[model samples]
Target: MHYALAPRTFLFSHYFATGLRIATGIIGLTFLAYFIADLPTAVAVAMGALCTSLMDMPSPLRHKFNEMLAGVLLCSVVALLVSLSSQVEWLLFTVIVLVSFLASMMVVYGRKAMPLQFAALFVMMLSSEAPSTPLQALRHAALFFAGGAGYMAYAMVVVWRLQRRLKQQVLAEALYELANYTNMKAGCYDIEAGLPAQMEKLVRGQSVLAERQQASRDLILRGRPTPDEEILVQVHYAMFDLYELVLATHTDYELLRQHFAKGTILPLLGDLIGKAARDIEAVAYAMTRNQPSRSNVDYGPELAALDAVLRDVPVGEGEDYDAQAALRATANKIRDVIAMIGRLHAATQASHGALPLVPHTDMTPFLTQQRYSLGILVSNLRWSSPVFRFALRVAMAILAGLVLSRWLPYTSHGYWTALTIAVILKPSFSLTKQRRADRLIGTLIGCMITAVILHFVHTPAILIGFLFVATAAAPAFLSIKYRYTAVAASVQALLLIGLTVPHGGSGVSERLLDTLLGTLIATFFSYVLPSWEYHNLPRLVDAVLDANRKYIDAAADLLLKRTGDDVQYRVSRKRFMDSLATLSAALGRMLDEPADKRRAPDELNRFTVQNYLLVAHMAALRLLMQRYAENLPAREVETALEAMFAEVRASLGAAHEAVPAQAAGQSTWIAAWPGWAPLQRRLRLLQRDAAQVAQSRTAIGAALGRD
Candidate 1:
């Protein structure tokens, strides 16, 4: 289905919902305070709400509440402290630097704490709006706390009421990404899109899919779901299995195109896969609307057509035979996908059965773990730590921005420069550069748009409506697209100031000037103690190898009947996928960096693809074993697989070592075992892929000047 056709599905998304909640809280509190008390009180309350709202992310209820509460308390305290010291210029400067450092340092605590940290820094910047006496500052802080707490309470209640719906939203999001991933894979058969480009797109999509799946896991796999929420849990499980099937569908696209360039089967296969993707998307759309999904397309015709085309192919030997086998396997995988979609649709209507009880002991490991302790912060205090360097960067940038702002004519709004710096500067140079560009362009566009509106229309009600929309759109798009967020934020900030402060003009020119200055400062400082992506490639490569090693062992264990599909095996698989995704993401960022900073682009790309194939081969092997375990010679197959696994493990462990010729040629015996031909073929493919990975690893070592 075309996404443009289903506007409500996108509107009901988790990101939009979060933004709308934040907008409602901010606008509701601001206008309510304005009408009941005064404009200043309304501004104070709105600032508080906005600060706390930054910490509102998709998480478990307990974490969400605690994090927002921490945001409210910290922001209020920061505002109060900064306000109390505002009378003394040097003291205020000291406070700003110290707060900036500490807040930026919170990255050591991981992602969840990031918003809380930013909330504190944000309030400090906002606190610079007006200097206040100690008594008046305390009153302002109290009002800030009131707005924050009030919004927190309101958000929690709203979340609680819609908790189930929220869970559905998150799960549906994963399905949406999975659909997108599948669609991207379908592009591989187009032949015209180019294999290298399609693979790059697929790799990037994998990272996004990994993130979405993790989010779904974090939410859906947390506490045991109630009976009413069981369908979501089931769909969640089915989605991951679907993702695995999609991964298993990976094959030599170059080979397929080379062999089938003149055939109709390739296009038919791509069309079928495309239809399957749409099927998944339709399910996601239904889930988003809290409705049961009914399949609207029949795949039988396409599958039959594919099968008929395959039947006409010569199936003796050579590339034609290999291509035929690959096409048949892919068609079967697609059939399985369509069947799984059917089951998934039924799952939305009613519970299939009780999901396997996840062991409590496995819960912590399954969900992304974050250590919220002082020790983590303390350990990251060293200069070698990226967080430490980032904190320093932020502090120095804030100081520079503050110093530069003092010389500007609009010195009263000098905090805008610092705020821009705070928002633009990130840990990595690539991200900072991207944010800098987005901030400048977004701010420029937003300024012109706001200026136009303010020039032509002066109706208070109309102006307030625009302000509400800009505010809502700001946080809503922050996670989705930061450029859009930047634009909305620019509009919102200008509108807020124009409405609140007396004789305040559009501030368009000032906004542009401050943003330009901020971006330049950010760009300059990004090179200061920057964390290069190449610096992390070796560790990430090792991580991928290690995870793959563990994954192979897990699959070996399962095949040998040494273990069931237990938590250990699941964790191993997850870590492998996660590591591969992490490596892919880092490579993506590295590509965006200076060309000189990119180490072994071709080698790294090969390494990433080899590792990806390794996982797919393992998944396909596991699936084969599961389906054919009853008929296969388990003992003999295990014995052969053990030898193969050892060779793969040794190659992974010693990056410089090539796969031994004897082991690489050991697949001859696989054909001798006629009873387990399917498993043998998978094992052979796995060995081949493992050797390629070893070669890629050795090349990476050479490129990186590693011994």
Candidate 2:
């Protein structure tokens, strides 16, 4: 928790673990070949191993295996194709461009088939510098394939062993969020605190729950369902249940403080919830250590106190006392939540009961859906696809750089321009921009370090040592920060070029100039066909609204406890979650854009906050319905609430709010319901809130729609 460590905390943990694993795999395969064979063979195999290792991201072992295999095949094919066509300049150029396009399009499949494969294609492009016969190309490609295969085998085993640890880590993260939510809940009783601030924290809690839910879903979906994995299934299922139970979490500071400001039981809820949170923290520690949980958690006293208070509390008189009724409902809800926590405590015990050191894998596709079909590949060619546009942009830049590098009379530094274009231009404008900056900074730092070493340390052995260290460190930093990766990689490249070619610091100056040229080329090409998030926001917002609308309808029906509705409810839930994720991604991209281009940033942020609040409110309603069969605002008031939400939903995709005059009698109907009528006022407030968001939406559309 020290201030200094907070900035670099992300550099450790899995990044460290996986970095060490892949670095060892890459360097080990490399040296093994080096000791037994010639330098070219050793370099080819090492390059193959390093490339494959880079693709080994966090995922199910099955996907890791496929990723490694794809790397091997793609590398071999690219090498063979380039070598075969090297005799014809035009043929080689066309082949590389087409292959690059296809390789980049692979990402349309899913997260599993992305940047790794793209890197593989470019590594092959770099390999074209080697002049070779077809037979030599095949031999080199085979060695590369063997290197990739060896590393793949090692990675599969390592991941298979480490997956249990990964799941435990996920469990700890859930508990961590549980602590945050509980602490937030405990502090939400301040009547004078800002409502917006309190709501933000509350929404954050739901967001945490959403993440836990996704983790559980991934766990269950990772492999085949069978009796052998029953314990793991139970653990994942418990997470889903825990997320649902936690969803009933909400508190209005003003209402609660007014009710308990002078009462003796003012700290009752906090006392109970705080104790439960500590118990979860203990379980989290056990999970972190991969140890069995302590058998007796004993939140019994807190639960007992809560039960006693709930038993003794009286309902107040008069229709003016609906607030009191709402307060009682909130108290009862807390009691139910305490019981749920006890269940989660028990589930934690059962999960730890059979914690296996090594887990099993089975017949799961590399991705949920097949992404390699001919149709999918062809479909990605449209301008609507960002990946396609990016691939085209990079290909165009590469070809132009090559032609201009020759005509500029600086053929020696020409490859640098293309190298920069390949490495820096990513799928999004903001990403490419960030990478460009990071690449320049990292390269400059790395070039300076290399210059110092080359000036003083001319011994071959020491230089090789530095090169080896840099090579090993590159993949490690790639996962943590691209800037660090770039630094290490640039240093390695400069060291190799200096030692092999015997240049007197010429490599350093050339790299700097080449980098500068590359940056200029990349920055210009980025504006060619930018995929700005501002233009994409409406679709993302609409998707979230549509998905949540379906979720609300299905959830409402489920609260009615109808049978045969479970299947539809689940489908709706997944869509709602997926849409939310997409919206978050778009927002992230929008925030990352140049400030001048980011119109209405404050409004966009508020829109996100409002959506999060909506999610928290809906979750609370669902939990209350499931636990107590209680209609939150009564069945009659729900009609008006749903109607209001409908207007809000329609406002998301359009530039104007839905008309209010059609609902002439909504206020009158709401007035008839004295028990939960106040919820109607919240609904009306939400409707009015939509108007502000709509205005911002119009302004953004105007800016982005300009040609």
Candidate 3:
């Protein structure tokens, strides 16, 4: 599993910024504890830094601060509560179960809050043994909270001093992703490339692009200067134009091969377009590095040569309409794309400008319901909601874990069992199972390392220093590699245990035993009314169908010359892109399910594959329309195409309604696309693809009968 690196994704500057900041926070706070308070007091302060690390998500300074602030309160509150309730085991158990349920439910609200919630849970484990007394516990929480605040302050200073550099990094990443998107789109035009697979590749790039763009926007919103903001708007405008060009670049490989089967020129043109896309991607790279763009290089000579060749190519008339019309449309689309690329290249090279306002992004905001509202809670009570099902499953699992720990007469580490359940048990069974395996494997390995460390590392200063390093590395690797994160955390746990209570609880074997017990309980309880992906598949299918309908509607308008405003076109494309991503993501989750739980995977796979192919065909027709520019289709041809798109929509609309119950049949979305007329080959290609979709849906319907 190779990850794509952005221009400066793993540069020394980033490493220095992240590693130095974390190391400073932990080491400074740890020493302050040793000199100003006891080593245990220092440990408390160091524990506060855990919240700081968890909030190390790559976000703007403003968002980062708020997240850290929330972390401080969550950890402090959870620590205090655990400390206060420790005298009564049952009360503490109840608290863990309730908190676990609520925390696990956080993702349904969105990804923004999940990390903070999990981090708070992790800190609660650390603070559980802090102080038995209320006053001492409060002091411990305060010290830990201060440790977190110190880390946040250090971060604030870094961002404040290096805002532009940080902003550049964000912008660079966004531009890099845009380049990848363009290249993937270009790949689809290559005659030999796999359409099904290329579209999947395109989806991956699009998701990454969306993430980077959001990060860039967040930076722009981080109280930057007006000029900085205008610069961001320029970057945004460039990407917008890029997408419009992408929309206009629609092509069908089969048609391309058919129309120019005997020609070297068409294939040469394809190769040239691919080269142009690469050059555009190079421009994106240049933007990231703050270097002058290669877009300044003239494209006129190469394109002028191609134009001479095209002008000389015979427009064999009458029966050769398919070849002539397609060739002309293809040439026009490529020409326009080349022009857009040059414009973007020039825009990227220019450092200063009175940037025009690009339209605002169609991104949805972080949604929150009334915090204390019973209404929000009540609304999620249905069995249909994965969130509700997950909450119940987690609540049950946590309660069972608490019981298991207590029922075992010899194990004193009941909290370890609870922590394991909290960390490993996800709403989805496959995900929970994966985490359980990771938890156990990571725990066993960590325990072995812990035993060796305890045997050889006797110097207190060295141990503290090692703890500092472990603390700094864990959260940094948390998203990159969860296995590493698991190891870092386990090492921290063992180090703290050896440091604070060496004489009383020094055995790594006991920690391993508790981890084993927790893994079993989490595994067993994961199936307590698990939220299977099968339950959610219908909605995903519905989303795909609906997005296609809207895209076709917008494309029909473009073809008919009803409107040239790309606002609807862009919106429809976003919906289609977003839906494709979501459906594919769900399919991946479905693959992770137990064999018995996956009712009709082949059907789901076909649904996805056909949708990808159909969308590609749709893009081709749109491209021809883009090339047509101001010329409306002949009135009769325009009416027939509009009718074709409407019937497709109506057919899919029926399929969508019938999907959840597994009652849909093949679509009646078939029309020959005026195959005999003087219509464009692009429309005929769309017609063929749409018929295939209807047939695919029928096959899918047969496959989904089990549902």
Which candidate tops lDDT?
1
| Candidate 1 TM-score, C-alpha based | 0.95
- Whole-model lDDT, candidate 1? 0.82
Give the per-residue lDDT of model 3 (tens digit) for 1-707: 21222224444223334655676777786787789878777777887876666776666665777777877877778877877776677777777666766666665755677776677667765556433777877787788788888877877777768767666656665666666676667676566777666756665566566666656656754442465446555655676666555644544444556666665655566566666766766665565455657664455665777788778777776646566666665677677777777776666555565445555544333112213345665678788778877877777876776677777767557668767877897766767777888888888888888778888888878887777777766665555466766787788788888888775444577778888888888888777777778777767777787888888888778767788566677667666766877777777777788897775666666666556655656665555444443544355456666666655665566563322221122222324433323233445455555555555566656656557
Once superposed on the true structure, which residue ranges of model 2 sit more than 4 Å away at CA?
1-12, 87-91, 170-216, 224-235, 245-286, 293-346, 351-370, 383-385, 403-416, 449-473, 476-480, 492-509, 564-571, 594-606, 626-707
- Alpha-carbon local distance difference test for all models: 0.82, 0.64, 0.66
Residue-level lDDT of model 1, residues 396-432, one tens digit each, is: 9988988888887764366888889988888777778
- Give RMSD to native, each candidate: 2.5, 6.3, 6.0
**lDDT (0-100) at residue 296 of candidate 2?**
52
TM-score of 3: 0.79
Q: Model 2 compared with the native: what TM-score?
A: 0.76
Q: Report the CA-based lDDT of candidate 2 relative to the real structure.
A: 0.64
Which residue pairs in candidate 1 collide?
none
- Residue 30 displacement (Å), model 3: 4.1
> What is the C-alpha RMSD, rounded to one decimal, of candidate 1?
2.5
